[model samples]
Target: MAGDRVRERRTVETMIGMYCRGNHGTSAGLCAECAELRDYAFSRIETCPRRDGRVRCTGCGVHCYNPVMRGRIIAVMRYSGPRMVLHPIMAARHFLP
Candidate 1:
């Protein structure tokens, strides 16, 4: 479970990094907005009610994020999800059951 959370966090960070780099034109690290979103995502993961970290957020019954953040993350996911092929290992680990 703990390992799962770490991977989940890494996946989120990777997606956000890709989004920030491509959209925000950050060459090195996350931009401020993406950084805040990353932190919020990490906090949400740490405090997730499903401590085992078994379920994908999309499949979960809980909608933990507020509307604005939810929309932002949905955008990030949409953009990065297809491009995840650029990061094959993370994509495989993320999608593998």
Candidate 2:
């Protein structure tokens, strides 16, 4: 539901923020590249047909993103996924079973 959508949005935002800060030296807001990715991610999340709370985008059947965007997001997640522990709540939500 709505809570799931909000949680997903927050999770992506946190991951993108961590990636932007660490990789792009952005302290307060996203860089232009990160901002574009963030916007694309948010839009995709909003339009995703599979709204199942248990089904993460990584595991979903849908291939909603274009190739370039998919590659970009994959990189972001790969970089930020392990670093999520810095954010305790998001880390738990993301890494816990």
Clashing pairs in 2: none
TM-scores, all models, native as reference: 0.92, 0.90
| Alpha-carbon shift of residue 19 in model 2 (angstroms) | 0.8
lDDT of 2 at 3: 84
Steric overlap count per candidate: 0, 0
Candidate 1 C-alpha error for residue 43, in Å: 0.4
Please write out the lDDT profile of model 2 over residues 1-97, one tens digit for every residue.
8888888888888888988998999989899999999899999988999986778776788999999999989988999888888778897887775
Model 1 Cα lDDT, one tens digit per residue, 14-78: 99999999999999889999999999989988888976667966557788988999999999999
Off by over 4 Å in 2: 95-97
lDDT of each: 0.88, 0.87
lDDT of 2: 0.87
Best by TM-score: 1
For candidate 2, the TM-score is: 0.90
